[model samples]
Target: MDFGLTIDQKSFINEIAEFCSAHCKAIDINDLEKRGADPEAIEQKLAAKSWYGLPFPEEYGGSGRGYLSVGLLIERLAMGGYPYPGRLQITMLNGLNVLKNGSHAQKMDLLPKICRGERTMSISVTEPNAGSNIASLQTAATPKDDGWVINGQKLYSSGAVGERNIIMVAARTDFSVKAHKGLTLFLVPSTRPGLKFTRLEAMGRNIGGLYEVFFDDVWVPNENVLGEVNKGWSAMTKGFNVERAIVSAGYLGFSERIFNHTVTIANERYGRNGDSGKRGAVMSRLAEFATELQAAKLLTYQALRLADREKLSIEAVCQCKVYGSELAKRLGDFCAEVAGGIGYRMDSLAQWYYRETRIVTVGGGSSQIMRNVAAAQLGLK
Candidate 1:
């Protein structure tokens, strides 16, 4: 895979970095968590700039820049220090799913709205019982007179309901076939009757926190079924690869922030003793972190390339997810230790890094799952 980016791509990435640092500076996650706030102001700013359409097709009211640009935008946002594109990421990715699989009318109706940020989208996959094992999801959608009534619950949905927001839910339409075989994806309005959302308190990255969604007899017509019935799992798996790649990119950006913060603190502490950060041991460790971060970026970019081509290699994705998340975790740990008590403060960047980094290894296919995937792809017994 080519590591060099086009001049336009490079410039776009720099532009995104500047925009995120400037626009996302005021987005306080604590405030969002407390108030259950949605980042609508930031959302509107991105919309006006047409960034919400950066990667979709021109026919869908987008810039047609492709998925690589989207990944870069996310990476820059995270490195810009706040990394609060929680809803944006979810919307763009699930929008891609709709673009890829929805009917002609569904695409015409929803895709343009998605690009314009008039209709945000996300998934509700994790259940009280199912985490990484998506195959066992028990949400049921029974067909009734040309429509379906969904009845079940989901956990860790990204955002709360909005008048213009839609959520993709996976439900078993045919329980006769076991596991992933009988599931279908449906797009339902967050404001639809019988649908509910309750916020789930979380550690950090709490841009409104995760949510618990309840569906009681929520109904969607045949037009709302995403992809072919029973083919939902295929579309979902494809989107999972995209999500893992983007997440790895985010981790790469955050790893950069952690490294910069740690080094600055170390330099100041060492200089206080007149060593002027001339500590060779400290420098060596920092160098190691920088090297690892670069490697993670490479893996993430490679995965993004596969995502663009729509020919994702699961093994390659596992490599990106595993290495990038683990690298971020390591950098966060190292930074917290280097900064000592200064890092432990509630308001400190070090503490924030430590908290944010904790979730990397747990979401979107944990490190253990990634290793298992890699092993299977490698033909290991």
Candidate 2:
């Protein structure tokens, strides 16, 4: 497959890089981990630039760019030390799901707010008992008069921190049915009563930290049902391919940055030390990482292209997510080794990456879960 970037794509990437350089300084992950940064200003800046709407259709006040364009923009932003902007772009995934399964009124009311960055969205799937095994989620939504009353807890919901966010929560709507069959999605506003958010302390990238959200008799209107009741499992899973592709792009971008930083550290340490053996070995390892990074990039781009064409295969997205996430972990470890004593410092990029790398493996889906998905796609029993 040709990996060439179109002229317009190239120009767009340059524009993103320039904007990131002007507005965002490289984040100090250590500081962020201690006390989360306020994302309000950054969110507003990205909104003003229309970066949040890159992947949505123009009718929703978006740029009408394809998923591939969104992935490329995410990569460029991350590489330029502007990872937070990409978080805002994640609303596009929610927007896509809403467009596919939401009522026309729901779409009209939500998509424009998402596109304009007037609000943020999060997918609340993981519960205490369900991380990769989405079918086992215990959140319940019982039908009430003209609405649903939801009661349950969600864990590690990333963007559900503040009042301006809306979470797409998965709950069991029919307990008599099988776990997967009973599941349904609801669009719950964070400002609604009976909703409580408790922030969780994390190792790195804590700009908007993970949260444990409890919905105690939280009421949602009938119109807020995200898709057909009792069919949300399919609606939610249908968007995983695109979400995984974009996540893979973010992992690839962050890994590329880590790899470059390691190279610079290696060169500075041994480039002129006359220690030929050590220098050569370090260079060789860097070369291996570079090769892996390139392979991950290709896989990510292929997945994005397929998603844009509405032909994304489950196995393809799984492969991209699995390989790209694992590569980032490995790159982080290699950076730590190359940075030696300095890497142990809290402020070191290597240390920050090492702490953050595990999130990728666990967040979108675990490595084991991705492998299971790939095996199932291959008709494995």
Candidate 3:
């Protein structure tokens, strides 16, 4: 199958590259390890270009770009050394979720803000006791006279810090049924009286650090419910496919960047060396990484194309996530090895990627979880 990008797609990528050149810089691994990008600044730059609306419908002030386009945009931005703007990533998926599952009023109120980059949102599903086993999440949302009362704790909510104004919370609304069937989704506001957030110290991707959020009898109006009660698992499943695909694309782009950097370093260090053996060895390793990166990119784009056609396949998405994430880690390892002692230093791009690659395997969904998903799709027990 042909994997060439269309002329329009190539042009758009070039535009993004130009934008990155003007507003973004090569990230400092040490600084990023401590904190994330400034949300306000990132928002301003993105909004100026109307990039915030790339994946949304035109009525929502978006550009009506397809999902594949969004994925390409993300990959290009990440490849340019941008932090990937956690809020933008969350907002893109959250907006799609809201558009698909939210009530009319919800869409009318939030979509415009999302398109304008005036609002930030996050998905809060993982809890202290439940990470990959989402069905086991204990967060509960009980119906009351006025609304639903939510009481539970969420962990590792990446963009749920003060930056996020809206959080799509997953909770158990019914206990009599199976855990997955009894769950519901709610759009809870960060400013709600009973909601609180505490930051979690993490090793990398420090911007909008991981958060531990506590909901103590927080009341959400019935209108805030997303999709049907107890049917949230289906909605979440669709969103997860989208999330994994975008994440995979981002990994592919970042890994390509790392590979390119390594090649430059290898050439600069060993270019004039008389020893053909050492030089050939480094070149071989680089060639292998380049081949893997290309394969991962194709897989990720295939998933995105499936999403565009609304034929999202769990197996394809899982394959992309697992392969792309693992490819990133492998590339990081190879780059670090080539850089030697200098790579271990805090300022080294190789060192930073090595640390950052750890999260791609764990976040969105772990590699183990992806394999299980693929197995299930194949009718394996």
Candidate 4:
């Protein structure tokens, strides 16, 4: 099998890199100090380029690019030290999954807007009580004449604060069945009367607002139910496979960016204490990071390949998510050490990179949970 990208893929990479270079040439130390980008401006900028929907189908007004192209786009954008690309990744890609699984009416209503950047969508899965144990979710959906009344809260919902829609909300439509079996999915409007979004403060990805959302009697119409009642758990699990795959791709890009910066700085930072020995140490550490980054890239690319092949890649997804996220964390730590005192400065992107990488280990699924999945795949307990 060939590992190198084809000419078309190379052209796609070039296009993404050109866009990143044009927009991200001027890095604002002030923005780093502020810890947030102007969301409105960022949205408009990305929308103009159709970056938000690059991975969606053409019918949805997207660029109609595949995941490989999408991954390259995200990597370049994230290397800019702004989380704008991540916000797009969360909103647009997850929204596409909804299009794939949702009713035809649902797709027609939302997909065009999502692709046009007139709207954004986020996934609502993790709740205050159900972080790792997705099947243990307790959000309930009681039947009404025209719809279902939803009541529960979701936590750590990325980009939900100002998003237009979100999918993957699990509600128990049949309590008699097992927890996973009883759950259903819906596309709930974030601006509905019974929905409330609470912003969460965080160390990184500050520009992409994380939120905790409450759904109190949030009425979701029968037309908005994703797939079928009591069958949504499987759909949601499948979506998770997609989510983990792309999220790992984004962080892998970030890891490469941070590692590159650390190497460039280590080679040039002239100091009294920075002897040849220190320089050699930094180079050796960077070599390790490079090796790990290559491992992460291989895993992530393999997962993408599995996804494109329509294979059961749930196990590969877990492995990529776990390994890529951990490698990102390690790269951040090593970068800090290599950069010495300046790395700890709040004004530096290195500090922010470290913070961002820390979130990866916990999000999607914890490293421990990932390991359990990997072990179970191996026929272990």
Candidate 5:
């Protein structure tokens, strides 16, 4: 695969980097973790530049670039280790999925606002009962006169808080059908009655505001159904592929952050004993992390290219998520180890990195779930 960036892609990369360098200063992980804290100030700050919609269609107030450019933007944002840009990308991509499959009215109402960064969207898939087993999602959408009465609970949904609109969700639309069938995606306004959000406390990337959304007979219009009824299962899966690709890009950025911190600390920090000889062990670990980070980066880029081509099968995307997230965790651990006592201290960047890294293994989908996907794809069972 040709990894070389074209002139346009190169220019896009430069623009994103300049934005991050100029505006992303002084924002650290701790500042991002507070409940009900607003990332909107920084978000609006970036929206002024209009890079928020790089991957959506230009007709919908976007840049109209393809997935390759989108992936590049995500990668750069992740590498900055700042959260607002990543949140923007996640919201834009989720909104785009609705455009890809939702009714014309749905697209018209939502996509433009999302592209302009005036609104945000999120995917609500996980629940107390449904973590990796998406088929087991118990959120129910009962048929009603106007549209559907959605009543269920979702957990760990990122960007639910403070988003203008949300992708309200449900499952088992037809009880006769199997678990995976009849599940559907919906376009619900956060301001809608019966839809409530509770913020979830998490380790890293707190700016994303992971949430528990409850749809208590949340009334949605028939016009809001995304794609066909039973066919939502297929559409949601496709959206997940997109989500995983974006996540892999973020992991790549996070890996770079930890790896850089590890090296910087190793080179400059004295050993707890104040001996320069401690530098030798630190450098050795840094070299090892660098090597692993390179391996994970190459795999992630490969996945990005495949996703750009629309060739990312479930198995391939899962593989990318597994390696990239795990690599991030390993890098974080290495940073903490290299920093010794300082790394373990609260509010230190390395401690934050360590906390954030653990979540990567569990979020998106657990590493075990990815392996299960790969095995099923390979017919190993």
Candidate 6:
């Protein structure tokens, strides 16, 4: 019933905010090809402070802070405009996936390094052909002598380009069984032979290094298999509930920053024109966004609450993901509209947000798929 954070939690959020203040500036990239604040360096700094383990258990060198704390951590980082916000979210969830599905030796070897920031990870699910339809994936892994040869193309595998990165790739291992049952998950090292990462130079994704990971007959030993072969559907979807809950919070936070900036600029610019009628109407429009933002916050927080109890509801996760991502998308356009010319500049965060929010809606699950899932969960076809 309470909608408040404890004193300790509030202070912890403040500490995270302060810790990130130095790295919280808008990305700076010169025409000379130099960019600001290496994403890896910032990640390592966060790791040194044990932040990458914000939601992990302590036995694996994590802080054991739980999912709700991680949601807050992600939101704060995104609010600060930290460039690697998406990467950190996936990094944390990838570790959680390994913990949930990896073998004991795999866990012992990887978890410590992951939590310590010596290594990073990403999940390669949505292939070019498989966006929302998991059953439609065509990527295949064939059994060879003592290992498996993987050959597939994955789209939108965020953060898969880093040197120490390992990607959890989903591939079909059998064709005779049901589509979901025939799939397997593998932890493929980013630097492994036959794996190529081509940066997708689309708008607003440079910060996350969104890439299409191509596997040209990559080989992985049996030990690299995550969970059981022909049973990867569960392992693949294990992180989505928490991802919707936590990553959606980041969307909310980024939306909040963009919303706040728009209001400031709108008020200042509109006030100067001395048109009280126009200014009042604009403020009312902003009020609508604010109300929707509150709704998003409630849904996201509820999802986080359920995750902490390990009772995450499919409906709750879908609601948060759909509403939060849509809000960001709509809010970005509105913010740009209200800010007018000033919002278009590259130095400003508004333009980047304008591009990024459009892509967020389709990342975890598309808004349409989210709605369908929520309706189905409620016994609706």
Best model number under TM-score? 2
Question: Scored by CA lDDT, what does every candidate get?
Answer: 0.83, 0.83, 0.84, 0.76, 0.76, 0.81
After TM-score superposition, the amount by which residue 150's alpha carbon in candidate 1 deviates from its true location, in angstroms, is 0.9
Tens-digit lDDT string for candidate 1 (1-381): 346899999898888878877887787755666666677788888888887787788998999876678888878877775554467777887888887788999999998998888989878999989999999999999998798999999998887577888899999888899788999999999888999888877776566457899999998898899998987789798677777887788788888878888889888876557464456667889989888877888888888888889877898889989998999899989889888889888777788788878988988889998898899888997
TM-score of each: 0.93, 0.95, 0.94, 0.91, 0.92, 0.93
**TM-score for candidate 3:** 0.94
Q: Write the per-residue lDDT of candidate 2 for residues 129-214, one digit (tens) a residue.
A: 99888999999999899999999999887767667788889999998988899999999988999999888887655666667899
lDDT of 6 by residue, 274-362 (tens): 58887888889999988998898888888998999999989889988988888989988988787678778876656766877778888
Off by over 4 Å in 5: 270-276
Off by over 4 Å in 6: 29-38
Which residue pairs show collisions in model 4?
none
Q: Give candidate 4's total backbone clashes.
A: 0
Best by lDDT: 3
For model 1, the local distance difference test gives 0.83
Which run of 10 residues does model 4 get worst, by summed lDDT? 29-38
Candidate 1 deviant stretches above 4 angstroms: 1-3, 272-280
RMSD for each of the candidates: 2.2, 1.8, 2.0, 2.6, 2.5, 2.3
Expressed as tens digits, the lDDT of each residue in 292-329 for candidate 3 is 88789889999999999989899899889999999988
Model 6 per-residue lDDT at 212: 90
Worst 10 residues of 6 by lDDT: 29-38
Candidate 6 collision pairs: none
